[model samples]
Target: MTMSKTRSEGSLPVVSLPLPVDVTAPAVARQAVRATLGGLGLDGPEVDDVLLATSELVTNAFEHGEKPDRLEVEYSDGRLTLRVFDSGTSRPKLKEPSPMAARSRGLQLVHALSDDWGHELCSGGKYVWAVFSLARADASA
Candidate 1:
């Protein structure tokens, strides 16, 4: 994984990374996410929600989509945005998994936790994204 500071959005900083396509992608992503959010002075539930959502996006790419390529993470104006791009053509959607099923609730958790979540089809594949609100008042809690 590689990280670099990007142009600022308003007063908040933006950071983007190009990650490898491997089994360790999720772990790598979680670490980067923690550092970025921590550096921005965001903590507590905001950090937890973003970490969980990041894992879901990366894990979903490894299990259901094609090779994962990049992750763009940004904190701007009181919100966090995470985007995971992959080389698969599959469209992301929520599924109704049986109660006894051992898996298949990644997107569901993202949908429930994030203020908003969605996926966009790109030229080569698709990019899944989620946004979390972390206003100053909420971050301190």
Candidate 2:
């Protein structure tokens, strides 16, 4: 995602991050998000929540979704959006893993935190996203 486009009226300010999908990229991206949102006066817990949510989603993209060149995070006025790209449109599901499975917490965690989340099939790949309300974040801050 890029910053050149402005969101439509009453739509949401849109900030985009076009970064490589690498091991350290997600962590770095999370930090960038924190810096950006925190500047708007969001408190610690809210920032942490969004950070955790993004971390979970990015981890899933790295683990399951194809490692596309970039991860698009669209941050507007009242909502934060996450868009991760992959080669194909794969609808990921939360499977009840063996009760002891060590690596299936991604979607579960995301479902618990994000207000809403889903996927979109694009011309060449897919974008999985989640939106969190800033109002709740501000109130909790």
Candidate 3:
């Protein structure tokens, strides 16, 4: 698989989920992200990276955003976007990776894996999103 640099321009491709606020809901977020990327035709290590990043960001939302059931995803044009919306007003941020700490790696991981990610304010709260490039789907001979 090839990892290319992101161009300046892009479009939105997201799957928004309004889930009940649960605590550290990684499994559900994993399923949602996997399904979204699966539908978008991505596979292999890229798929795993996308899923891992999604899980981390979703966990951060629950831990910091304090909103669980508001997770959502958007996939389009070779991009699988993961968004976790919460009632909290705080925005998501990436901190320097610390090797001595036992935790505090969610945003670090998300920043490492995704091509680009950010947060946006919604009507009721805020949404944190991570977007990864879709791997080229192999065609049947």
Number of clashes recorded per candidate: 0, 1, 10
**Clash pairs, model 2 backbone:** 13-76
TM-score of 2: 0.79
- Please give, for residues 1-141, the per-residue lDDT of candidate 1 as tens digits: 579877788877678777777889999999999988877777777688889999999999888888898888877878789999898988887998789999999999999899998999998899999999886645548
Global local distance difference test of model 2: 0.69
lDDT for model 3, please: 0.70
lDDT by residue for model 2 over 53-84, one digit each (tens)? 87887777777877654555565566767776
Off by over 4 Å in 1: 137-141
TM-score of each: 0.91, 0.79, 0.78
Candidate order by TM-score, decreasing, is 1, 2, 3
Identify the superior model by lDDT, candidate 1 or candidate 3: 1
In model 2, state the lDDT of residue 123: 74
Q: Identify the runs in model 2 with alpha carbons over 4 angstroms from their true place.
A: 1-12, 75-77, 136-141
Residue range with the least summed lDDT across 10 consecutive positions in model 2: 1-10
lDDT of 1 at 39: 77
- lDDT (tens digit, per residue) of candidate 3 on 1-141: 111223222443445555545653677667766765676566889888877887787778788875664665655565666677777788777787677989998888888898988998888778888877774484332
Please give the ranking of all candidate structures by lDDT, highest first, separated by commas: 1, 3, 2
Decide which is better by TM-score, 1 or 3: 1
